[model samples]
Target: MDSEFENQCLEQEENEEYEETESSSVQEKNNDGETTKQLSPREVNTIFNSETEVCEYYRQYGLQNGSGIMIRNTRKIDGVNTYLTVACHRYGEPNQKVVDSLKPKPVVKTNCKARVCAKRMDEDNKWHVTQFDNKHDHDLSPSKAHRFRCNRKLTKHAKRSLNLYDEAGIPMNKSYNALVVEHGGHKNMPFSKKDCENYMREIRKLRLAKGDAVALQNYFNKAQSIDSHFYYSIDLDDENRIKNLFWADARCRATYKEFGDVVAFDTTYLTNKYDMPFAPFVGVNHHGQSILLGCGLVSNEDTITFVWLFRTWLTCMFGNPPNAIITDQDRAMQNAIEQVFPKARHRWCLWHIMKKIPEKLKGYKEYDSIKFQLQNVVYDSIDIDTFEIGWSSMISKFNLENNDWLNGLYEGRHRWIPCFVKDCFWAGMSTTQRSESMNAFFDGYVNAKTSLREFVEKYDNALKDKVEKEVNADTRSLSTTIPCVTPHAMEKQFQENYTNDKFKEFQKEIVNVKYCECMMLQSDEAIFNYQVEEIQYVGDSQTLRTVKYNVVFIKDMELEYEVKCECRLFEFRGIICRHIIKVLLFKQNVFTISSKYILKRWRKNVKRCHSRTKVTYSTWKDTEEKRMYEMVCDAFYRIVDLAAENLERCNHLVGTFKKLELEWDTNDKGCSTSIVTKPEYFVKILMVNVA
Candidate 1:
C-alpha cells in the first residue's frame, strides 16, 4: 500500500467508517494511468499500519510525501496582501524521492516536557517535542524540571560577575578595609569588575579636568601680572600717591612766584568698599585748573575728619598755610579751617550764599515777587546798606518767619563776595564749580564695589592723565605768539605818502587797544557809522590835497574807507585795514595794552598760617603717633546722626521747598534756584532753531 492509502486506512479505522462528500473527496491517477477513488474506512486503516507501503504509494502517485510542509501564517508574515483559509492546503510538488532526500531540521520547542534534544521537524510542519538538554544542571532530580543552572565556575566567580551574595565564597568586590584605606571613607562601589572599571575611568577623567583648571588658573595669574606691569614703574618710595600734589605745587610756585595765594577748596564723596571710602579733596589755583592735593580713606565724615584731611593736605602740598581758603559755608568745614589754618583768609562762594536766600523763606506764595526782590539784591549796583534794606523789605513782603539759617550763613557778611549777584570782573569764579567738576571726574575712578587696590591704581592713573593734559596745553599756549605790531608797523614803514604823523595822531585819538594776559591782541566783529567831513593839511596845504575819508569797521577787522576824491592808497591798497599799525606807533612812547588783552580778574588774597613754633614730623613721638590712629568708634556712630541732621534741616529749607511749588513762577530766579530753563521753551526753541 502507498503512504496515502495507509493514511486513509488509519483514518477509516479510527473513525470506523468514512463517507466522502463531493466537496471533501479528491481523486489521483497513477503513473500507469490507473484512476483511484476516495478510500474506504478499512483501506484508510490499512494505510496507517504500514509505512513502507505508504512510501511506495507516494512513488506511484507522483507526489512528494513525508516532506515537511513549510506552513506560514499568511497574516503573521510581514507584508501579507491577502487573507488565507486555515484548512486549505498550499500548492507544491509532492514526491516520495524528494521527501526521502530531505534531512531532519532542528526546531526550538518552547515549554516542552522532554529535556534531551529540544525538538525537530518530521514529515509534517509540526513540532517533535524534546526537553532542555543542558548538563550544567546535573544536581536536579531526574523526574523534576524545577532546577536552573548557575553558570559560573565558583561562588566567588558568580558573585564577581552578577554582584550577588554567594553562600560558598567571599565577595569578589573590594573589602571594607581596603575601600576605607584607598578612598578615605568614601566606600561606595559595585561588586562586578565591569562596574569597577567604569567607575575608575570616571575618577581619572575628573582628576584630569581638575589638573586642566589648575593650569589655566596659573596662566591667568601670569597674564594679570604682565597686564599690571605696563602702568607700574618703581621710582621714589611709595611716591605715586603724592605725585599730583607735588606737580601742582611746583607749577603754582613757577607761575605765581610772589603772587598772593587764592586757593578755592571743595570736597566730594567717592564710593568704594567700606574698608576704603576715598574722600577726594580738590583745590584750584588762579588759572582755574584743579589740583588734587590729598585724599583719605576715612571711616567717618565729620569736623575732625575734615580737619585731619585738610591739615595733611596743606602740610604736604604747601609746607605752610595757603593765603586764602574759600569753600561753601558749611559750619563744620568753617570751624575746621579756622582752627587749623587760622591765618588764611576764609571767603564763602557767592553762588552758595545766594542759593541760601530761597532756602530760608518758605512762606512766599508768589514766585515773581521772590524773583524781583532777589534780583534787586544780586544785580542792582547798590551799596551794602541799600542791599540789607532791600533784603529786609523782601522778608516783610513774603510774610516769611524768622529765618535763622540765612542769618547764620551770612553772619560774616564781608566774607561772602557776591560775584554772580552782579556781573563782576571775576564773573565766572564765584563758586568752587571747577573743583566740583574735578570731583565728578574723581568719582569715576571709584564705585561701591571697587576693591582697595583698584581704587589706588585708578587714582594714580587719573592724576597722571590730568597732569599730562595740562602740561601739553600749557606748552601749546606758550608756543603761540600774538601779531601786536602788524597794523602799527605797516603805517610806520609807509612814511611820507601814508602821512605817518597824521596816521599816528589819528590812531591815538580814534582807536581803542587792549592786550590779553598771554600777550595776544583782541579784535572783535563790529560795525561803525560815521561820515568824514574833510582831511586837510593844517601846516602845509601846498604839499597835501583836501581829501575827505569816511571809514567804517566791519566784521573780522575789515574796514570800508570812502574818500570824497579818488585816493588810490585807500581804495586799491585797502590801507584802511592796517589802521592798527598807526595806533601801535603812536603808543610807542606810551605803553598800550593789546585790544584782545585783559588783566586777569583779582582773586581774594588768601592768608598763609605762619610756622610759629612749628610742628615737625619728628615732634610726633611714639605715644602721640599711636594716639592719632586710635580707633574712634564713637565718631563713626555719630556720623549717621550728623548726616540725618543735615537732611532734616534741608527738609524745612525755605529756598528748596518754595522752588518745588508749581505756583512759584518758573522764571523767577529766587523761586527757582536750580539753574535750569523751562523744558518746553528750551525744546521749542531748539526745534525752531535747528529747523
Candidate 2:
C-alpha cells in the first residue's frame, strides 16, 4: 500500500490526487469518472487509519504545508503508535531567506490556529484523526505579514558611531551616508538609512522628553546657586509654563555696564527647536569686535512679551538702561521700548530697514534704479535737509509719492537715517551690525534642532571661546606694536594710541586724505577760526563738488580745537573724518591729533579701569562678586604655579590656611563659622607627595 501511494505521488504530482488504493471499498462510478455513492462507512475509516496516510491525503489535496504546519507532539500508547498533535505555523516566512542574518531575530507572528489531533485504537493498532480544524480566522497579506525589525544587523560599533554622531549634532542623512561609505555601498550595508533615521529620532525624542524648558530652568538654577551674580529669571504664563526668559552672568553684566552706552538689541534670530526668538544685547568692544552683554528668549514678538523681556533684563542689570538702543522696526517692539526705556534714544536697525525695501518695491517697474536711488537717500545724505530733499526727489521720480510704505519710511526716517541722528552717540555703529555679528558668532555653537540643555551648555562654551579670543586679542594688542604706514605725525599718534583694528580704520581715512585738500575759504578773527573748504569728486555727476566746514582754535584752560562739518562723520561716528584731517594736517600745521579729538573709548588700553569703565559694584547688591571671583581665579592659578615651583609651598600654604581656620573657628560662640576647615585628607596627599 505504501508503494502504491508513492507511485501515485510521483505520477500525479501536478494533479495531487487521481486515484485511491484498494485498501478501502471500491465505490460505484459516477459522472466525470468520479466514484463515491457506493462507498460504505468502513471504507472511510480504513483510509484514515494512519496519521501519515492522512497527511499524504492532505498534501494531495494541495494544502499550504511550507512552514504553515507544525508537529505539536506525539505519544505511543502501550508500545503502539497511539496519538499525535498538529498545528499551523505561528511564524510566517515571507522574507525568511533574506533575513537570515546569522544572528537571533524575531519571527513574524500570525493567528493561524488550524490544528489536528490523531488517535490510535488499541484494537486495530492504527492511528485515526479524532479532531481537526484547517480554517484560519485572520487574513494574511503575503508581503506585509512579516514586519518585525532586525536590530542585530547594526553591530556594536555601528550603534556607538550612531550615538556619537547624534551627540555631535550631525544630521541623520549624513550619518547614514557615513555608514554606507564605511560598508562600501548601500547594497553592502547591513542596515538601511531608515534605521539610522529612526534611531536618531528616538534618541532626540528621549532627550526632549526630559522637558526642554525644565532643563534650561535646572541649569540656570544650578548656576545661580553656585554664583548669585549669574542672574536668570523666567516669566511663566497663566498656565504656569515658561513664556519668557532672561539671563546674564557676572562677566556679561560687567561687560554691559562698561560698554552699555550704545547697545543693539537683536530680536530676529530664531533658530532653536522651540522656535524661541533670541534677543542678544550686543555692543562693540575697543578691538572693534562684537561683545554680548546679555541674551533673552521670548515665546512671541508681541508687545506684551517684549515688555516682559526688557523689564526682566533691566531687573538683572539693576535698572541700568543703555544710552542708545537699536533694533528691527516692529510696532510691538517700538511700543515696548517706549514703555521701558523712555529716557533712551530708541533707533531702528538700518540694515533691517534697508533689507525690506527690495521686497516692498519688487513689483515696481524699475526696481534696481529705485533701490539705488533709495540707498543714496538713506545712506549718502549730508544732513536732515539733504536727506529729506533726496527722499522726496526719489519717491516723486519713481511715482512712489502715493505709496504708503515709502511715506511711512519718510515719517520714521529719524530712527534709522544716520543724518537725522548724527549727534546721538552710537559708537560708530550706524545699524545693528554688531548684534548681527553676535548672532552669526553663536551660530557655530547652537543649531536649530538643539535642545534647551544643549543650548545652555553650548551658549556657555561659545562665551568661553569668545572671551578666549578677546584675551588673545588683548595680549597681541599689548605686546605687538602697530606699524605706521604713512609719514603723517597724526597717523603715528593714532597707531600708538588706538587698537590694531581701530588703527586700521584710521589708516583707511588717512590714505584717502591725499585726494581731499582743504583751503581757508573765509576767516573769523573773533573765534580764531577759518571756514575751510574741500572739493570731492562726485561719482554720480562726474564733477568736483565743493563742501565747506569751519574749524576754530580756542584756549579753554588749554589750547583745544573744535570743528563743525556738514559731513557729520565725527558727529555720527566717534572718529574724525578725512575732511577734518585735511585741515588739521595741511593748514593748521598740527602734527599730532588734538587731545580733545581722540576719544578714550577707542584706546588700546581699554581694559585698564583708569580712564575707561570704572570698577563699580552692583548697586543692587553689597558684595563685589565679579571682583571676588576674579581674585579667587587669580589666587588659585598663582598657588598652583607656586606649588609646582616649590613643593614645600603647598605645605606652607596649607599650614597658613589652617592657622586662619583656627582664628575663624575659635569664635566667642565656640562655633565654626568659617567656610573652610583644616583638611582631613591633605595629610595623605602630603605623604604621597613626600614619597
| Candidate with the greatest lDDT versus the true structure | 2
Q: Give the TM-scores of the predictions, in the order they appear.
A: 0.34, 0.63
Query: How does each model score on lDDT?
Result: 0.38, 0.68
Deviating ranges (above 4 Å) for candidate 1: 1-260, 269-279, 285-287, 353-363, 379-383, 419-428, 481-691
lDDT of 2 at 260: 78
Q: 352 in model 1: Cα distance from truth in Å?
A: 3.9
Deviation in angstroms for 565 in model 1?
A: 46
lDDT per residue for candidate 2 within 11-60, as digits (tens), equals 66534232323233545553358766422122223326577765544332
- Lowest lDDT 10-residue stretch of candidate 2: 143-152
Candidate 2, residue 309: the lDDT equals 84
RMSD of each: 39.6, 19.5
